[model samples]
Structure formats: C-alpha cells, structure tokens
Target: MKVLVTGAAGSIGRVVTVGLAELGHVVVGLDRVPQPDGEDSAWHTVDATDADAVAAVFEEESPDAVVHLAGHPGEASLPDSLTSHVVTTGALLDAMVEHDVRRLVYASSNHAVGRTPRGGPPEAGPVGADARLRPDTFYGVAKVAAEALMSLYADRYGIDAVACRIGSFLERPETVRHLATWLSPDDCVRMVAAALTAPAPGFAVLYGISHNTRAWWDLAPGRALGYEPRDDAEDFAGIIEARPEDEAEAAHVGGPYATAQFERPALDRTS
Candidate 1:
C-alpha cells in the first residue's frame, strides 16, 4: 500500500517512514518544514496549514493511506497552541476528502484523556475509552479537535478514520509511569499497520500503548490490530530505577510528552 506520512522528519515520523518502506509499502513523506540537518526521505516540504499545498501533495502522491503526524509537537510554553490543530490537521482533512483517500490514521495523544482518573499503574486496565475528554492543555484541545475532524470525515465523507491516542514511546521503561503506557517504536508501526488493514474499523479512536504491568487503560482493538508488542518497559526497570529519586525526577515525569504545553501559554495549562 502506498502511504503518506506527514511530519516525516519527526522522531516517530522518521522511523515510521523507514519502517513502512521496509515493509514494502511505498512512502511519500510530507512536512511543513524541511528535512532536519541530516535526516532524509521522499520528502515534500509543504506547510500542513496550506490547503492547496496539502491537496497538491496528496494529488501528486495519491497514497492509499495517510498517517497524519505533521503538527507542532507539544512544548512547555507554546506560542500558539491552536495553529497546528486548526491549520495543519484541518488542511490535511480537506486534502484527504478531496483526493478520495481511504484510510487515515490520525496521531492523537494519550493526553486526549489525561484528565480522567489515573491513580495507579496504567496496566491496571485503562480508565476506559469512553472517559469524557477533559484536555488539560491547549495541545490536548487540538488533539480533541483532530479526533472530531476524523469522526466527521469518516461519517460524512466515507473516509476510514482512526484516531489513535498514543501512549509513551520510550527507549527504555525506567520510571513507574512508563511501565504501564509505553509504546515502543515497532509496536507503533504495527498498530498503524493493523489500523490500516483491520477488517471493519468503523470510525474508531483506539488507545495506542503496549500491554504492560502498570497500565490503567485497556488495550482492546489494539490486539485486533494484530499488534503484539515485543518491547516492554519492564526490561529497563533495573537500570532506570537503579538511580534514586532526585536523579530520576525528570525521567519520572509520567511521559516525555505529559509536560507538553503544545505551544500554548504556560499559564493556561491544567496544573
């Protein structure tokens, strides 16, 4: 299948593109920014916010599936949180509809439901997908909007949309938080592959995390996606936890992205 990956220069995007290529799928990379200093791909640098640009890229590439990953990643203090949501993703939606793309895997975040009840380990079983979306930051708000757009497109335009609320993607599972919610890079690819080919995924928003000991969210259809994660956070427990608290404080911040301000004013985050 020909796949288009937006934000092809990003951490996951870069890996996903190469992974797709290795899987024998043709990849057309899209990004608003140019290739990073040394990174590379079949890149087409187009601002995700531009409708015509996105449309042109989609029309030219005509990929069978589009994994929308292009957007400003969350930061502690974002200058504008809504730009990526309203501009980048919104434009991509229009392009998808215009080009008659079939499957679209939107990169939603765990924070989409972060405001829900999360007390113990994440592996205790998920708090539930139906948990009301109470976004704690402007970035979360954008993800919520992106999910809504996927729904609208799926229902109204016959687009097969899946909003994957992804968990942590860490090199090692060191702290208590990652054990329950780690999303290894390989698992990430598998999840996307599964979502793309799943029998009858009818407008779904599935959690994107691996099966781990301390999980709070249940990974249901994730299995159906044929995703069996090989990497577990527990493997690194001995090493990561080997250090004491003060030494691991930064590492223990739940997820690397939990601190994301999503380019919004720091004063607006839900503390």
Candidate 2:
C-alpha cells in the first residue's frame, strides 16, 4: 500500500516512514521541513494547517493510507498549540476525505483522557478505549476535539479512522512514570502497521504503548487491531533511575501536563 505520513520529519515520523518503507509500502513524506539526506522516499514540504496545500498534496499523491502525526506538541502558548493541533488535523482529514483515502492512523495522545485517576485497585484496571475525555491541557483538549472530528468523518464518510492514544514515546524510559507509559519506537511502528492493515476498523481508539509489565493502560484494544507490542520499558529498569513523584503527580495519568499553567496577566488571559 502507498502511505502518506504527515510530520514525516519529526522523530516518530522519521522512524515510521522508514519502517513502512521496510515493509514494502511506498511512503510519501509530508512535513514543513525536509528530511535529512539518505531518506529514500518521496517527500513534500507542506504546512498541514493549510487546507489547500494539504488537499493539493493528497490529490497529487493519492495515497491509500495516511498516518497523521503533524501538529504542535504541547507546552507552548495556548493559541499556537490549539490552532496547530486542531486546524492541521481538520485540514488533513478534509483532504483525506476529498481524495477517498480510506485508512487513517491518527496520533492522538493519552492526555486526551489525562485527568483519570491512576494507580487504582487492580479491578479498576488501566484506562481503556471506553474512557471518557478529561483532557488535562489545551493541547490535550485539541486532541480530544480531533478524535471527535475523526469519528464524524468515519461515520459519515466511510473512513476507517483509528485514533491512537499514544503514551510517552521516548527513545528510552527516563523515569518511573515512563516505565508504565513509554511507547518504544518499534512498538509504535507495529501499532501503526496493524491499524493500517486491520480489517473493518471503522472508527476505533487504541492505546499506543509497549508491552510493559508496569503499563497502566490496557492494550486489548490495540491487540484487537492486530498490534502485539514486543518491547518493555522494564528492560531499562536496571539502567534508569526512578524519580520520586508527588501525590498530585501520582494521582493523574497526565502527571505534570495535568497541572501545568502558562502564566499570564489577568488582562491577557483571553489573548
């Protein structure tokens, strides 16, 4: 299958693009910036938020699937983050729909349901696809909105949209929280591959994390989509030091993002 990967120059995008190519899929890379030399794939420089630009690329590439990963990663000014996350995603979806691209693997975040209490009783279990939205930040709220948009497109336009509630995607586990939330690069690739190939995945949400024994998010939904993660953050347990977290941090799934505040004057709050 020919796949188009937005944010193809990003850390995860770079890896996924290569991974897809290795699997014999033709990858069309799209990003605001060009990838470094040695990336043997078709690439395009386009701003994802620009509807015309995205549509033009979709019309030209005519990809069979899209891995939508382009957006502002959180911790920035509120407006920039929201616009990038929501607008870019909206444009991408519209373009995909217009071009009859059937499969979409969205890079949603665990933060979309970040306010949920963690470390509960074993019966309580980890957060699943059925969990309600409790976004911890503006960035997370944008992801929640994007998920809804995907749902709409899938139900009304017959797009097979898979919202991947990705956990902390890091090169390695850096802290205790990471042990349970880390999404290894290989597992991330595996998850996307499964989502792309899964049969009749009309509209679904799947957790994107590794097979960590300490994982607090359930992987059953991902498995149902044909993803079987092989890596575990515990492999770095002996090498990485676990840091102590406060009660507030320990209470919620999003940790610091659940409590972050971008300081602003009262008069500038609306701005």
Q: Kindly provide the TM-score of model 2 when superposed on the true structure, using C-alpha atoms.
A: 0.94
lDDT of 2 by residue, 175-217 (tens): 7778888999999999999999999899999999999988888
Error of 1 at 220 (Å): 0.6
Least accurate 10 contiguous residues by lDDT in model 2: 262-271
lDDT scores in order: 0.73, 0.87
Candidate 1 segments whose C-alpha is farther than 4 A from its true place: 36-41, 75-79, 120-125, 242-271
Model 1, 88-201: lDDT tens per residue? 767887887788887888888877776554444645445566767866566777788788877887889888888888877665565667777788888888888888787657
Residue 177 error, candidate 1, Å = 1.1
